[model samples]
Target: MTFKNTLEFAQKLDAEDKLARYREEFIFPQHNGENVIYFTGNSLGLQPKSAKRYVDEIMTDWANLAVEGHFYAEKPWWDYHDRFAQKLAKVVGAKPAEVTVMNTLTVNLHLLMASFYRPKGKRYKIICEEKAFPSDQYMISSQVRFHGYKPEDAIVEIKKREGEHNLRTEDILNKIEKVGSECALVLIGGVNYYTGQVLAMEEITKAGHKVGAFVGWDLAHAAGNIALKLHDWQVDFAAWCSYKYMNSGPGNASGCFINEKYHNLKDIPRFEGWWGHKKDERFLMKPEFKPEAGANAWQISNPPVLAMAPYLASLELFAEVGMPALIEKRNTIVAYLEFILQEIDKEVPGTFEIITPSRQEERGTQLSVFLHGQGKALFDYLMNHGVITDWREPNVIRLAPAPFYCSFEDMYNFGQILKKGIQDKS
Candidate 1:
């Protein structure tokens, strides 16, 4: 897997790639009248060409069937969300009954916490990574506040050992133990947005359970980017947005996974809606709220068919290729990217320092490079040159080489652009 910083080498890899054809399936943004290197898939995935049809199918059904679309349309608006259950379940490595599409990621996170984050007796603290995605921090903080616990006392933030950019798995597990009887939940982003470090979910889940804490993951970065086995990992609950690596349209419908162990537990309280009512008797609405089986019980409203259509489009691609193939292809291209960047650094000794973990297993598709000598102006310069990337405050440029549309040549070309950017700034 030796990588050369040459267009021919990149083109050769693209030619040999099994997943290369998927690039054509997406419509990339143009800069200078040519396709731009869209490394922002970790933020908003490229639009799938088929998204329109899936969305139009729903619109057509509504036009033709009107009220009857609820029961008689192609996908049947009544159970439109069900169509994605099997397809999405495959992507996240969960049983069909364990996965369900519902509100957006943060909303679902709030819903799941209502059930899983119940603080009682001595167990009142929630353990999560320091610098969690802001929404999660706000959600956890609010949840604790609602329960009459101050965030400072109830939310335990696990910090990186001083001087380290990334968190050590052992430190995280040790933090869970330190809280012991006080910890009620261990909620962490499966892949950190800042460092792109893929936390050891299985081991973390085990550690959380050992201390009798409810465990969950915010999979916004992990879903579709990494291989997840939420079921096998004994993940108590999890949630993710579809817009990122899922390649669904921006701010689309999101999904959640509730372990089968808690599927029918009446003791668990959830923010329920009529859609989550028993399907057979939903029309015969009783004052009593009879819960549906599995993760669907967590759903709060009738799904927005239009919003879910694009996600269905992405899920179709995922179901076709599956994770094993996607992971293999992703690791290869990521390796190529690492080689290119290190070579650039070899030329310009302090161009950037990749804060993302070096090991393939510890990261997903993203490489969070902490710009050393350069700053946002250099990042802006790259953008002006059509090298699209995400810039985080302080000093990090996040580039995710998406498997959906980004080619190996994009990575190589980015290397050249970055090198020149550094030189020009100098």
Candidate 2:
């Protein structure tokens, strides 16, 4: 499909977009009395207007029902989290019994590691990508240290080829094979936060399992942006925050997946709490711990209703639109954005370099660009002019045209602004 940078063409595309009406559901930041061309959903998603209603309902229940809210409220506080099991399972491609909502992303990963990262004898090393998100690096290193092994010795990193910015699937598989019996766990980000590279999760999971290792993913960037098959792929466990493309508010509760195969294991190591005890017998308050049926067994405490309210609000929209429609719009909008960038680059040759892979399947909504002969000034200019984007180290700007809230006109408008910024800087 051909794309044009003209305003009229953009308007036509927007008029044809089925998801265009959904844009109004989001509250965009204002710039000069107009909505900003938001490109930072990969960082923090715009808040859904319905979020307030959801929160108000929770507050109302707390005020009216008081202590009885646990069982008497509209959405009973006791089983509040149960609402998310089916919804979240659909979002991440897992069975209802295999997924649950819980603590923040890092916290859930740590708890999951306790169950899956048991290193015995020669099978102690863990494999992960080089330059993973800082939180994951810290979590993996801390886990390694807690297990009485040095990170340098127990962690194997799959490095990108010298000049490449992305990891090849073959390279990842080769590392898994090379480590073989020594590998105990394979944990990686489903999408590289910086480059927006979508890893081959299914292949990686298979490779890790072949080497006798438990495999998992941190789906921080991948969850709502791309299609995933965690259950079909047999991933041991995975976790994702709801604030990114899912459009939940900042620092919201996380959703997790644990394969059904692990649900029946009685001896799995975990840091259990009262919330994870068998639901039927939870009120009995017995001395011995009996785990819940599925992924809910990993919960360390009761759900934070306030934090989860926004997430539930966002999931409603996701259910209405579904991932299929979202992916269709995502592919086109991102391609259009890429086209606009290419047009701007042609006008100011050598001024921009898109480091993200050109293949649609290899990336999601983000396009991380290397700004040549530009620095923070360009980023600052874009920000001031209402082109909300993300900036990383070494002169790179990440533009994520989130399909649910971003329209084709945003791509065209952003191109004009970008071209002017380049000329002004020159």
Give the alpha carbon lDDT tens digit for every residue of 263-381 in model 2: 98988899999999999999999999999999889887988998999999999999889999999999999999999999998899999899999998999999999988889899999
Which regions of candidate 2 deviate over 4 angstroms?
Answer: none
What are the runs in model 1 whose C-alpha is more than 4 Å off?
A: none
Which 10 consecutive positions of candidate 2 have the poorest summed lDDT? Answer: 83-92
Error of 1 at 170 (Å): 0.9
Candidate 2: what lDDT?
0.93
CA-only RMSD, every prediction? 0.9, 0.7
TM-score of each: 0.99, 0.99
TM-score of 2: 0.99
CA lDDT, every model vs. true structure = 0.92, 0.93
lDDT of 1 by residue, 248-301 (tens): 888988899999999878788889899899888989979899888889888878
Per-candidate clashes come to: 0, 0
Highest-lDDT candidate: 2
